[model samples]
Target: MRFSRILELGCILAGLFSGAAARPQDELVTENSSACKNPPKRVEWRQLSTTQRKQYLDAVLCLTKKNATSGITGAVNRFDDHQAVHSSQTPSIHWVGHFILWHRYFVATYEKALRTECGYTGGQPYWDWSLDAQPANLSSTKAYSTAIFDPTTGFGGNGDYMQPSVEQNPLNITGNTGGGCVKTGPFIPSAFTVNYPTPDCLRRDFIPWIINSFADPKLVANVLAQKDYTSFARAIENVPSFDQPNIHGSGHFGIGGVLGTIGSAAESPGDPLFYLHHANLDRILWTWQQKDLQTRLNQVGGPITPFDYSGKNVTLDFQINMGRLAGNATLKNLLNTTGGTLCYTY
Candidate 1:
């Protein structure tokens, strides 16, 4: 068999076996040829001290080299291509498919890279928003609550009560003003709502709700109100999949708008969190695969034509070379595999 064919077969087999056992270190491979291990539980966000945060951030920085950037671009191109082919006809189906494929590769590849490059040995940690769902649990410094919701500061505007904006306003006047300025909010006692014409449109204001929903029931409801990761995936699975105005269509607008706005406004690489946010979005797809393994695995779909942006038909294929997106070794190899070297546990 040809090498590519053999690789494809291996990937299929790996995907079938992914759920069978606890992931072992040897199953993962990196450029360094060393085994990767799971991260320590204490490495979670709340547990990290100031020094640890600095260390972790520095390590993450080192791992995100120029080459890593290129690899990410490649992954994006693949995604763009897939979307163009499949979404045009059945948008919802296409997006859910896109989510699953993209996240499977992302988590697998990034985990391997973290293990081999930064000596990071744990599973990826998620920011749970359940802790601050209630008005009382929010802290001045850590948790967002009525006490810290600042209109002038961190993403959202100040005070427990502030003026809300129209749902269509992408500037996030209630959260992220212009580009850099963010307003902080103190936790509100009410169940979070993302009503149209309320600055909460598109769920931008729900970031705090998402951050606090991990362990809190009320917070989970708040996050759910804005379509938590699971609901987002389910929305894709539901009929009229792509047309679901709230998630996929809005998601495209959100991502495309940010790219356009940030590209025009700054010379620096937009937000570092851009990739991380996408990564989390990708993780939702991974979780979906775990839930409906057979149905998800049997699928084979992509876009029909490349997207037309500013009159250009963007190319989508593995052959095209993207600058920072092309160079990352882990991402480069991941495009062709179901899970590649690493198996996802959670």
Candidate 2:
């Protein structure tokens, strides 16, 4: 197992994550932020120094070297713990009322793990796709040329040509350029391992067209112009079949590949880029919420079920959890980034 290769780090993860006694459900997690007095500010990926970028990658590597608390077979390391939980919760979290709330909490939990477990001191960085998806840049190569895909400082570039073993949903979506294993970057098959849903290389078929189509500045502005949370969520997440793809799908399909674990929606976190991608999404959500915090912060209304717009609306008190990673939290606490268990700003 990956964790066994790093004994000392394994001890750190075990003592910190597994060896602790169970606490009451009401206990605060990560840090009980007394205030956002000096909350760490998140920056765009380019804003970070090359050294800072390397440090962030190192923390992610450390996660892979640590033992997973979840004994599930596919969860070979601590990193896979997230993959397992996300895959399990996909149906409940996405397309629902708490989609934004639950993901906000999930990303915060990951930031905490990076800091407390892996000794990464920097705040999380986001990948702003808008800059790359501009109309002039939409000529196909602009988004693909981003440094975020750099083999050295970034996650890596496109995978080679190969066929997908299993066909997932959203059949209408087109443009999958590469399907083979990633040949370069920090997470090439030789340097990194992804064991969920059977071991495989981190693959990415970069369909820059998808990014250009959905994440253009005009579309993003449209999403932000939404009058309420429900409209905003639908604008970003779009419908179940992804017929009307949104920014969220832009990032996912733009990267364009089954992950190292090799699954689309559910198995996305298997790739390290998932966090950076989602961090940017969360930043957009936060940006929209700040327009009128009094109303937007409290405003949330969508179906309780995935793709079921006519179903019951999930309330603020709806519960979300990350198994042992973050026990449980409510949509209420997750609404305000700085006020709840979260204490970060973008």
Clashes of each: 53, 0
Per-model TM-score versus the true fold: 0.40, 0.87
lDDT of 2 by residue, 1-346 (tens): 1111223332333233323333464455433457445667889989999999999999999999999986555788888888766665665677778887878878888888898899988888888888888555544767877888888888888887655444432253455678667777778888887777467777777766667877788888998999998889888877534446578777777786332223365457878888888888899999999999998767788888767888888777766777677757767677778874777898
Across 20-67, the per-residue lDDT of candidate 1 in tens digits comes to: 332333223432222223323322344445454445444444453413
Report model 2's TM-score to 2 decimal places.
0.87
Q: Worst 10-residue stretch by lDDT in candidate 1?
A: 260-269
What C-alpha lDDT do the candidate models reach, one value each? 0.30, 0.73
Overall local distance difference test of candidate 2 = 0.73
Give candidate 1's root-mean-square deviation (CA, Å).
14.4
